[model samples]
Target: MRKKKCTMSIPTIIECFQMGMTSNEIALQANVTARYINSVLQQHNVERQPHSSWLRRYTVNENYFKTWSASMAYVLGFFAADGCLPKDLQLVSFSQKDPKILEDIREELQSTHPIKTNPRTGVHLLNISSKIMKEDLMKLHGMSPKKSTILEFPYVPEEYLSHFVRGFFDGDGNINYKKRTVSFVGGSQTFMEHLKKRLERYSFEPFIVSKEKYHRLFLSGRKTVYHFGQWIYKDKNLYIERKHLEFNREKLPPDQIKDRPFKAHKSAIEARKLKLLYYYNLYRDFPEACKSANIGINTFYRWISTDEEFQLKFNSICNEKKI
Candidate 1:
């Protein structure tokens, strides 16, 4: 009897090949002869590896996350910010707009897993489908399938804390050279608070502001931003290039550095006051404004009575609305 001809598309055949399926396996699944599958793979310049070799095509150090090293801490931190674990899959995936960072991470992890691009968003994705890796991430690092909102700061060793923070910063933090600010945004309030506490140990007075669904920890002004750059990049070689370059650019003049006496800093206080004023203007009611701004009613009243500048600004805004 004659064999059925290969009916699978070229892309499907290539995909199966890339997925570590042997030609015979693809042929069997597609209901075609093995020779037909081999020809299709050859036409696409895809090599036909033995079944055992194909199974080992994508190799990684499964024990990479088990020990605490600079690379391990950094990868863990980055994962906490950007990695995702599917509820039904034994996989951990990372998506980044910059493929360079993903490439760096893959190299650091010694992973040969292919990095695929999302055509729709032009994002690069690296998915490691290993049960051991997934289990280690969950059991060792306290990672969950959907960990954004409930993520707690992991216990990174003191010596490797900077590396961990830098990794997390590379994933979720931003630096504004023009504004002279460094900020971290995270979905978990607990995580942000813990991060803020850790940064405080380095003399960074970061302030946390609650957003609608997440929290933002911010360090503003020239002195803090410059020092932050120095702190996170100290003795660290693994970092996102663009951000590192931006941070290493010319330092601002000493005269431009403002003194920060309070923990919240002058800029943060001004930002909070502005946020309160914005809410007040939106609602035109003091109590409602306080609620929306996430500030206590007592705090609003105290700001009005204690700070002459804030009080004047509030009065001006209220007068402008009346007119």
Candidate 2:
């Protein structure tokens, strides 16, 4: 049988991706299935940007009040990082590959909304479509529907700011033990700058790096990384365990570190580069190689493009294999 043709043009899909439309939304607008939209997006290697909440539809929840609480702050922080309140859709959604994180979010919100998983991509999406909850988030948290570039710090109580930041960090932060860097990546310049100021208020030094379309706030050096980790995890049992464990590895005793399989930094980030090189040689096991090397697959590919030595070594290995 002849293969079915794609109805939507590649350019249109790219345009929608640039507009921060989710694959499903793009599919809906373009008269295609979500899977088809995703396939085309993958072909173009388009990065999936977060959705803006500007056009979200909702009924007012008169009972909602602007109260400060740890749970509310955490939910706001997590939403600021990875969630979306699509205007016309009348829904607030958070999607992550990890189901555990979604479960944590569900429990935090104390909501009955069902968690839906996309079988093809293994991404779990938590949807909140209730008008009451939508209005509550908007009024209490200063969450605007169109909050991408205009996002600012949420109205978190002073004492619970750390909890909120912790939730945001868990959603969008990255910790590189070898490099001793703690980074938060986002597209909102205002939000990032506010975060820098907030960290400064807490006596934590953070610097921001501007990329083409996004910004990254970096907290470097052992002192800052250690301090931030200790502060954020002080409450214990309220964080992403894997990240907290990795963050505190440096403070572990030698025996304890060994037992926990923690590798101390060798005064160099080159250690990670070398590991990446080793993984690059495992050509047949591409996904597992990237996982083992503790880097994203796209990042591994980018390294091959930018690093001459890495590219040369990979090419040489490929030549030797003659496959």
Candidate 3:
């Protein structure tokens, strides 16, 4: 009597592989031995990809991208600042002038990939080829391979939004006390617009200005910069110290901060509305605007609820001016 052959389909095996299942695991699910599963996969011309040494050395945690985590926020910020996704390849890369930054990012990600340095360019790069990560980033954050002009604002977790923003600011933002500006520069117009909208939520009046090929999100005025610096630097653990140090009030000239024309009223109801308008035009965040205007949180809420004209003006300004 002739014995029947194992009946698992090639498509099933491929699906299991795509899901990051090992051959043995796929075999268990299919009620077959591991060898049979590998044979089936091989017969279908699906060669198992070789794992990188870095990947082999470390236990890859796929759960990191399942939600908005502190590590994830930091990675996104680093990506926005100095990382690149090659459209033609499966690799995601981070390049930095400081190798330590790359090392910190690698540690934060728990990535096992070895850092590569280009002597000519004087930049250290950490490259990773991770399909699961790519999919997660694309699905969760809409990050595509050729993500330049197409980059959009991520749906960040509310509690960790500041962390993610800090990562990006650390990567690409600059604090110029002399110029009285804290700015972020990027090549994507879409990214710039999204950043402007996000800043509005924080009451930050970020101005978008085009310079050469890239766009700049600029928060000017000492009060505005000080408030922004405070918000972003609230937790220094996740930032580049050199960049964070520039925002230290004591380190900067007190005369410059004092001479600034921003005056706050004690009641801060009407003042909040005026500041909101100022920030709205600049496309800044609401909370930061409140802080900058010295409006108490409770007062801001009461004014918003009781003041009808204030509401109308706020909406009107946002509709007419915000980009």
The candidate that achieves the highest TM-score relative to the unseen native structure: 1
Model 3 worst lDDT window (10 residues)? 262-271
Can you give the TM-score per candidate against the true fold?
0.68, 0.59, 0.61
* Model 3 Cα lDDT, one tens digit per residue, 179-204: 56777888887888887888889877
* Model 3 alpha-carbon miss at residue 95, Å: 1.3
lDDT winner between 1 and 2, please give it: 1
On lDDT, the candidate that comes out on top is: 1
Candidate 2 structure quality by residue, lDDT tens digits, 125-241: 877655566677677777768777778787677788888888899888989986677889888988998898889897775656554678777776566677788787766445677
State the lDDT of candidate 1 residue by residue for 194-240, as single tens digits: 99889989888676656579788887666778888888888886789
Candidate 3 lDDT:
0.69
Task: Write down the worst ten-residue block by lDDT for model 2.
Answer: 53-62
What's each prediction's clash count? 0, 6, 15
Q: What is the lDDT of residue 216 in candidate 2?
A: 78
Kindly give the stretch of ten consecutive residues in candidate 1 with the minimal lDDT sum.
47-56
